[model samples]
Each structure stands twice: as C-alpha cells, then as structure tokens.
Target: MNGLKGLYLEDLVVGQSASYGKTVTETDIVMFAGMSGDTNPVHLNQDYAETTMFEGRIAHGMLSAGFISTVLGTRLPGPGTIYLSQSLQFKAPVRIGDTVTAKVEVREIIAAKKRAILETNCYVGDRCVIAGEAVVMVPSRA
Candidate 1:
C-alpha cells in the first residue's frame, strides 16, 4: 500500500515499528474524564488524589494507553488498520505536562489471517508507563 493508505499485510516486516508522542495536560485529563465518564477523584480532585498512593493527581491510565491507539491508527499500520484485541499493564503514573511516547513494533504476522501481533508500549522519558500487545487486521494488496 501507499503511505496515504497505510501498509498492506504484505508490506509488513516482523521488526517494523513506529511511534507517536503527546504531552499530557490538564485539559487532556479533564476532557478525557468528561468523554469517558470516569470522573474519578484521583484524576480530577487534587486534594483527594494527595491521599492516594500517587500522592498527587495523575492522568488517567487509559489516557496514556490511548496513545498506543494513536500510534497504531495513525502511524505504523496507519489509517486502515482494524484493531482486534489489546492487553495492557499500567506501570507508572502520568502527570500533567509529561510527554508520553507510544511505540508499536510488529512482533509476528499471520499471513493466512491477515493479522499482525504487535508489541505496544508507552513511555515517559525512560520509564515505561504502559506495556501491551495488540492484534490487528491489516489490509492486503490482493
């Protein structure tokens, strides 16, 4: 496939990878809370969060995880990729202003099924904030 249409199944290699980065912000957390209907105090109420293990308000875990989706949907597999499954492990807190970089690498390809298993990860500087695996159905040239 051409760049505009994303990579076709045949175009993928096991080690191919891509990444996208974004800085977490107060507006991002607030908007995510509203859009996801998860007004958890840990993510919204600073005082309340101060009592938690984080000791301060932290951006939602899913917000960081969502960066993985951004990398998949717009970067590696690009625009036509269909996400089939994902497994995630949240490891650290993401505070407002932290720049999160989401990375995805093709780990395995099942040509018969037109599917690819990718290793997905999000990092803040050198610390991994989220780690996961994703299965996606990629377009083909046939």
Candidate 2:
C-alpha cells in the first residue's frame, strides 16, 4: 500500500474508491484498548464476555471504524485529507478472528473548495458490520 504523503487538494474525484484491511487479532484488541482507554470487560476479560449477549468478547465499534479512516488516509484521499465528520452504525459484532475489510468511495467532491462526501463500509465476510458517510477535505497538489 502507498503511504499518504503528497495528496495536495486537487486529486480527488467524486467516484473514486479506496480499500485496505487485515485480520483482527487479540493483540490488536488489547493494544487498541490500552491506547484508547476503552477496556470494557467484554473487550478484555473473557470470563466476563462469556456472560454477554454475544456469549463472547467483541471488538470495539470504533476499532472497525479506524480501519475506514486508515483506508482514506492511505488510499483514496491520501495523506493530506482532513476528516470533517462521520456517522456509522454497527450492524454486527466483530470477533477476534474476523477479517475486516474497510472501504470508502467518493459520493460527491466539491472541487471548488476541495471537500468531499464519501460512503464508507466495514465488512466481515459477507456481513456488513458497519456502514456510514464521511466528510473530508482533500488538499490539491497544485
């Protein structure tokens, strides 16, 4: 994957798409928990998770959403992208073994001011675990 470093403000198209992903791992869950201070028992203590609605632990919703931001920062809008806002709904829990693929597609691009509307989704297998829209600012190279 290319590093997002030179995306100025004029390279975005309204129909472009970007995608990237990896398998979820317990280490990732633990690390994210430590970094974000979101160590809910369901995400850390397996014994406690065994009592939850899922009958096991589930990854944080924001963790899946992070994948979406990664795709945008490293692919579509690239490095110079600024996130304005985003809204997404979680449709399913992401287990530790689930391989999540995050994708973002441009729905509208405001070329005059270098802003864009993007539709984003995070999927685990055939299930759409999360989906939503995001507003971003892309800086032009020129």
Candidate 3:
C-alpha cells in the first residue's frame, strides 16, 4: 500500500484524523515478543495466560502501538514526518485474531516550529484498547 506524498507542516488542520486496521495474529504476537525481548508469559504462554484474568495469550502492548504509528507515519503527515515523542496507555488486552483499528487526529500544530501534536488511539470494535498522543515534526513544502 503506497501512500501519497506527505503533507507539509503548513497543510495540517486541527481535528483531521486518519485510521488503519490490522488483525493481531499469533505470528505477530510471537515475532513482536521475540524482537522486543518482552518474553512475559502472558504474551508467550497461553497456558500461563489462561490462569490470569485475560484467559488466553495477549499481544504485546507495543504491538498495538505500532498500528498507531502506521496511521501517523503513512496516512497523515506521512513519509517525511519526524516522530518526536509518544505517550501511550494500554487499556485492554488484545487477543490473537482481534481486529485493531488505530486512529490519529490532529490536535495542535506549532507552525513556527514545524511541529504537530496528535491524539492517537486504537480500538477493538467499540472498545478503545489504547490511547495516547504523539509529537512530530512535519517536513516543509519547500
């Protein structure tokens, strides 16, 4: 999926939003756990997970955060955007096969600084699984 040329700082508008979705698969959970060194039993061992409140294995929280990155870096300001910082809160367990949709909306922009602040969130059907904000420096049209 190719994205169009990115929007420059001057082109952003408050309240604008973009979204993308992905199904959390077992492979995705395993790979993310391996790559991130998050070997927690709740994410890697279903038997262990079943003993806990979630009832089964859950995907890494950061894995759901990556979906938010996809929307910010590919759909909004896009390609040339520079990610500055992000703050996130994990609200719910994302089980394998659950479809997650990430959404980002322009919250504020500092034009002189070429920066933007956005509200970021991920949802599973009607429930919000993650909520956060991101600061990014968007490229100039020049």
Q: If both were scored by lDDT, which would come out higher, candidate 2 or candidate 3?
A: 3
Model 1 per-residue lDDT at 111: 96
Query: How do the candidates rank by TM-score, highest first?
Result: 1, 3, 2
- Prediction 3 global C-alpha lDDT: 0.91
TM-score result, candidate 1: 0.97
Q: How much is the lDDT of residue 49 in candidate 1?
A: 98
Screening candidate 3 with a backbone cut-off below 3 angstroms (N, C-alpha, C), the clashing residue pairs are none
Q: How far in Å is the alpha carbon of 74 misplaced in model 2?
A: 0.8
lDDT of each: 0.94, 0.87, 0.91
TM-score per candidate, in order?
Answer: 0.97, 0.91, 0.94
Best by lDDT: 1
Q: Which candidate would rank higher by TM-score, 2 or 3?
A: 3
> Between prediction 1 and prediction 3, which has the larger TM-score?
1
**Of the pair 1 and 3, which is ahead by lDDT?**
1
Error in Å for residue 21 of model 3: 0.2
Q: What's the ranking of the predictions by lDDT, best on top?
A: 1, 3, 2
In candidate 2, which residue ranges exceed 4 Å CA deviation? 1-9
Off by over 4 Å in 3: 1-4
